[model samples]
Target chain A: MATVSLKNLTKRYGNMEIVHGIDLEIADREFIALVGPSGCGKSTTLRMIAGLEDISGGEIDIGGRKVNDLPPRSRNISMVFQSYALYPHMTVRENLGFSLKIAGATKDEMDRRVAEASAILGLDELLERRPSQLSGGQRQRVAMGRAIVRDPDVFLFDEPLSNLDAKLRTQMRTEIKKLHAKVKSTVIYVTHDQVEAMTLADRIVIMRSGYIEQVGTPDEVFSRPATRFVAGFIGSPPMNLHEATVSDGRLVFSAGDSLPLPGQFKSRTSTGDKVVFGIRPDDFYPTGHGLSSGGETEVHRVELPVSITEPLGNETLVFAEFNGTDWVSRMLNPKPLKAGDRIGMSFDLSRAHLFSAETGKSLRN
Target chain B: MKGFKPSAPFLLLLPAIVVLAAVVVLPLILSLYSSFTPFRLTRPETFYVFVGFRNYLSILSNADFWWAFGRTVLLLTIALNLEMLLGLGLAMLVEKATRGQRILRTLMMFPMMFSPILVGFQFKFMFNDNIGLVNNALQSLGITQDAIPWLIEGHLAFIAIAIAEIWSSTSIFAILILAGLLAMPKEPIEAARVDGCTPWQTFRYVTWPFVMPFAYIAMTIRSLDVARAYDIVKIMTDGGPAGRTELLWTLVGRTAYSDARMGLANAMAYFSILLSIAFTVYFYNKLAAARAQIGAEW
Candidate 1:
């Protein structure tokens, strides 16, 4: 395993720059996931690291050696593509041993390595089977086996689990995590799925519009978002931000509802400053005795008309409207709340987030 | 039975059946019946006479017929193999070219655009004895002091016909193989490179195997086309002064129309059909095997 460092890494296609001067240091044996929406250049960044794409301007150092000019093979990196990309003609044995054979490994050595990889992946029985004969999950395993047999310094995955079904994706996610743990190799995985990034990454790099929004641990990024984009992107149902202004040391909503600001923002903002209050769906709870009685617990209460209720067995997702803005709240033991029903809900202001309305930057930062 | 009846399909197929009976079925039955009789085109009254396998026996024993048959096979083998090799080389080179590829492809197809008869005449004039461009150029370069008997010599004439045939049809192979190259998945090739395969190794192990099926398909199609090659050879040498380049078709034409021995010619034509069938079946089986190697159903 080796540490990978990208210094001022930039990628441009003609006049339009995709990745704008990204500088990151991935430590050895650390699983760093690059997560973003489509066209956010997450995959492009991984490809540049893999040497599949040329770095327009930057230096990529692997283990203290600059690998900007090196080919993928020379860099000693293995990439598992999103499509699996197994040779359709070769059997699983050949597929796993292809790199070894090309590198001039002996027949005995190839067989040993292939056998070892197959055993690790539980593919010993599928050595003679072609890729077309394998199921989707089995093919995914074969693809991983191909990469593992190489035993490169860095493992690059390009949304490898996106093709599987939901359950299979979850199972393969765990398998990949276990494999990474066993190998202890530095891995750079790229995916748009925040859940995958949250679960698989030791450090998650959230990217937007080719720029790094936030890079932190899952809990850090979830609980302490650095930007409005990260606050809105890293969560499942996402954080809801409503326009508000600080008036007389209190936050005033657009719909005439007023509540005192949380203590975290007391020193950051002055009166009459415009800001946005952000709250996650799960951060809201059913109000008890109104917001005034909850001392030291900064709670803001609001009455909203229920738009829809989605029951997901354990918790119910309640979609409600406030000040013409749709917001979702997760409630425990939520019954059949019909549409147009006005319900009083309380937001936990201590868990709430604030961002500057004009700049889209976190106000608490 | 009532539920199974579909009168619409049968009604729709009625015209096709009638056309097939009139155009294909009736002619096939007539030919088979005529093969049993001593039918001569000039003497139509002889059609009623039963001859059994007399025409077949005559063709079987005929030295000229067997020689022409063997010559056709030789021409087919030489022309098809040369065309395949040249076509494969051209396609590989074209596939590697990044710029001006479209222009090169279009230029390569220039030969295929020409009629076979026109190509034959062009080559014939270029290879003519005294006043031809080839002879004049050779004399001007002092390579040869005298005009070479290009059309008279057996081997030279055969080579000339084969060259003309190769030039005219090599594009068919190139285009088909190029299509295969375009359709090939880029991932395996990239993987092969990352696997440390050299350019030659990648082509040998990955690229060539993928294109073999396409090459076989082109070969099968061109074999049938070249097996019936007559326009060029007829215009160039007309089976030569001593029948040295006597192919099956030329021999059959001489016997059928010129000598008016229709029965013998029909017998020769029927036998020659075996050559086409053999090649078509052989290449088709190879195509199937190649596809199977790639785990494709077709």
Candidate 2:
């Protein structure tokens, strides 16, 4: 395992820079995920670290050695591509042993290493099969096995599970986590799926456009997002956010509905100050519904019309009209609610987030 | 009642079958029939006279015919190999060209754009002993004192013809192989690089095997093309200066048209077909093997 560090890492295409200079330090044996939408430069940063791409500027050090000028092979890093780029002509055994063969390992040594990798990946049965002969999940495993046999200092995965079906993706997610635990290598995984990042990463690096938005543990970013982008991006059914102005100790929406601002944010804003308010579904509940029985709850009473409800077996997602837009609220335990039914709700002010409208930065600090 | 109606597909295809018989099969049968007889275009009555393999036996024994046959084989082997190698080099270079790659590919195909007859005429004049650009350039450069007899010398004329053949058709290989290269998946190449293979090793173990099927396809097509090649050799040397650069097609053309010996020419044509068959079979098997190696099928 090795610590990988990027010092002001920048990538430029012609005159237009796609990845702005950003610094990140990845600890040894840490699984760091870079997650963002397409064209956000997450993949570019990963490729730069893998040395598959030429960095326009800045420095990348892997295991205390400068690797910016080094070739991918000399950097001692392995990558799993989204396409699972297994050599189509070679059998799984040959594919796994290719790097060792290139490095001039003895035949017995290569065979032993390949065997160990195959066993770890459950690929012993498919060792004689070619890539085309294997199923997609099997091919993905072989691709991982190929990297495992190399025993490189670092592993870089660029959306390796994006091609699999949902069920397979979940299965591979567990497998990858297990593989990391067994291998204990410094891993840099890139994905657009926030759930994957939240589940698998020791720390998630959320990127936008060309810059790193925030880097923190999943729970830290989830509860204490540094930017409005993170507040909206980190959760599923995403955090409900809206533009509003502060008026007489209350946040007034464009549609004229107002809710009391959390007392803590009173000092962060003055009357008529524009701010973006955010709240996660779990933090809001119907007064008599799940988690609303706590006597100490400072629930601000509001009556709103329920618009939609997604019953996902264990929990039902309730969407209700509040401040002119639909706000999703999570209902745990049991509550039968349908569209157009007016329900009395209590806003969880303590969990509310306020961000400066102009800067899109969280105002808590 | 519905099942009893005429089958539309076969009915629609009947005209095609008739046209193929008239344009292809009829002539094929006539040529096969003619090969068995002592036919002559000048003497129409000789069409019916049976010759019973006499043409075949006589030609087999004829040393000059064997020399032309051997020379044709040599030219085919040398020209195809040279063109493939040159084509691979050109395709790789063109693949690497970043800006104006489309224009570069177009320029690479320029030689192939010319008709073979035109290419033959072009090379013939270019190889002329007295005033050809090659000899003139050599003389101007003080590389050779004498005006070299390019077409007059047997080996030199063969080289000249081989050069013409390779120059005109190398693009066929380049275009096909370039297409293969373009269609190649980028991930495997990157994977190979991460697997620690050098550029040459990547090409050898990954790129080359993927490209073999395309190369073999081009080879099969070019083999049939160069087998019955006539116009170029005719224009360049007319298989003359003592039939030095004679290919099978030139020999067949002379016998059938100039000598008016249609029966013997047909017999020789049948023999030449064997060469095409051999090449097509060999390349087809190789192509199949290459496809199997990569687990890809058309």
DockQ of each: 0.48, 0.77
Candidate 1 chain B, run of 10 with poorest lDDT: B189-198
Tens-place lDDT digits, model 2, residues B206-281: 9999998989999999999888888899999999879888889999999999999999999999999999999999
lDDT of 2 by residue, A1-365 (tens): 49999999999999999999999999999999999999999999999998889999999999999999988989999999999998888989999999999899999999999999999999989989889888899999999999999999999999999999999999999999999999999999999999999999999999999899999999999999999999999998899999999998999999999888888898889998999999888778776665654653456778899999999978888898987789998888757888999998768888889999999999997
lDDT of 1 by residue, B1-298 (tens): 7678758989899999999999999987777667677678899987788798899898889999899888889998998888888998999899999899999999999999999999999999988987778888999999999998888898889888888899899999999999888888887776666666677777877888888899999989998987778899999999985888889889988887888877777777788888889989999999998888787755
TM-score of the second chain in each model? 0.92, 0.94
lDDT of each prediction vs. the true structure? 0.87, 0.91
TM-score of each: 0.88, 0.95
Superposed model 2: Cα runs more than 4 Å off: A291-297, B1-19
